[model samples]
Target: LIAYGWHTMVTGQNVVLYSRLHLVCSRPRVLRGILWMIIANWFISNVPTTVFVFGASSANPGPFNRPYYVWERLQLCLYFVQELIISGLYVYEVTGMLKPDFHATPPPQKERRGSVLSALGTGKRWKSRKVLRHLIYVNIFIVILDISLLIMEFIGYYEVQVLYKAFVYSTKLKLEFRILNQLTDIATSRMRSS
Candidate 1:
């Protein structure tokens, strides 16, 4: 199904990001937490939808046929909360990396930003910060779309909800791919320059 494909794409990107973060980030625990959250969210949100979509064709409908409106709402709520946590973890990691070491002595007046290390460090940090900002914006947009979908579903808009869900997931997958591409490009350029 479309949702399954989207889930797989998102999961693949997240796995790649997780590995990259493990290499570059100071906090492994945070990265692990984010990975776990992503796995959990995928299972909680996507698995049931997949089952329902596939199982609907069977002659004897399983328990999935039961209307679990409350379950759907709960899943959405958990998805939103986990996304907030994941985004917060990303921001935390980026900010932590960007924090200058206060214990180190200041650079000499003559050897300040002119040094290659300083220049590259500042440039990389700026790029990372820009990426972080983009991530935050993307997360906000996703949250907004999720809320809209939830509201529509609650209002008994089942007719359009299915189409909306597919569209939103596809759009989200595309945005995620864009972010991952930009990140990899940044990393590759930095590596080549270094």
Candidate 2:
């Protein structure tokens, strides 16, 4: 039951992560690759972990113990890498967003430059960059949380590690609201500008 619960929670977190990534990134290839990665990891990690977890608790657990011991670490490592890849995509796309030179619109020749456009654009860009920076900070903090959980697991703190994992993912989900509003604002501004 715990395994089932954990699986459902972590899987939802990955889905949320992918949805957020889809917002800022437009390339179909990148998005598809990430979706496939999520599905693949879901099968590759969760199935075996579930099997090993149940088996290890059975009455005659000798055979399953060694496998479970190795599998627990492998599963966590897989999740860590999966998250890093998703976060890496965000950082890449966000970095490109911060570079607005190519996307900048030319000022009208008839009118004075940057009167209304410059003021609005400058303020929006500043806020956007600040939001992007916060996004990066959130990612870093998440990575740090994952690292701490990984360390606890490796050091044989299985009991605490499981509870900590739930906390970390919940915290990550909470932070997404900050990015959500900022992203919506950016999209609305872009639409209006166009």
Candidate 3:
């Protein structure tokens, strides 16, 4: 039950990250590649982690202890890198959308004239850009949370690390809905209006 729960939470969090890429990114190839990496990382990290964690806790733990210790460290390292890659991609895409020349298509005729008239005033693009910048901040906050988990993991408190992960993942999902969803809606509307 423990191993299964751990696998679900860890893998599920990555899937959520993967699913949100469409909000800021338009490239299907990049999205597909990332999905593959997440799946591969799951198999590469989870199986041994489950086996070792279980074996290390068994009645005959002497042999399993050495391999489990080494493998768990490797597994955590893999997870951290996989997470950083996904978050880093999210940051990159959001930042790209922040650029002035990001959109390939020009705005409609009316919008272009209104944009010229309201040169001094902020517009939807500006608002979305602001939201996107704050989105980066949220990602940084999440990275900090992950760092705290690493600290706990290194401190060798397995129980506390597990509990803390649930808190961190829940917080991330809530932040995503509150902020990322706003940006997604903005992007979607712009695409349709264009």
Per-prediction CA RMSD (Å):
4.6, 2.8, 4.1
Error of 2 at 50 (Å): 1.0
Using alpha carbons, what is the TM-score of model 3? 0.81
Residue 105 lDDT (model 2): 64
Worst 10 residues of 2 by lDDT: 101-110
Q: Give a tens-digit lDDT track for model 1, residues 142-190.
A: 7788788788777878669767866766776677666667667666776
Residue lDDT tens for model 3, 1-194: 77787788778778778877766778989988988998899988888878887888899988888887777667777877887898798888877776653343465667767586344224655676677778788888988887898788778987888788789878877886776677677777667757
What lDDT is obtained when candidate 1 is compared to the true structure? 0.64
Q: Candidate 2: where are CA atoms >4 Å away?
A: 101-116
Highest TM-score: give the candidate number. 2
Candidate 2 residue-wise lDDT, 1-194, digit = tens: 87898799889888988998898899999999999999999999999989988988899889999999898898889989999999898888877866783456656665436488666766776777788789889889989998998999899998898888889878977876677677778877778878
* CA lDDT, every model vs. true structure: 0.64, 0.84, 0.76
Q: What is the TM-score of each candidate against the true structure?
A: 0.63, 0.88, 0.81
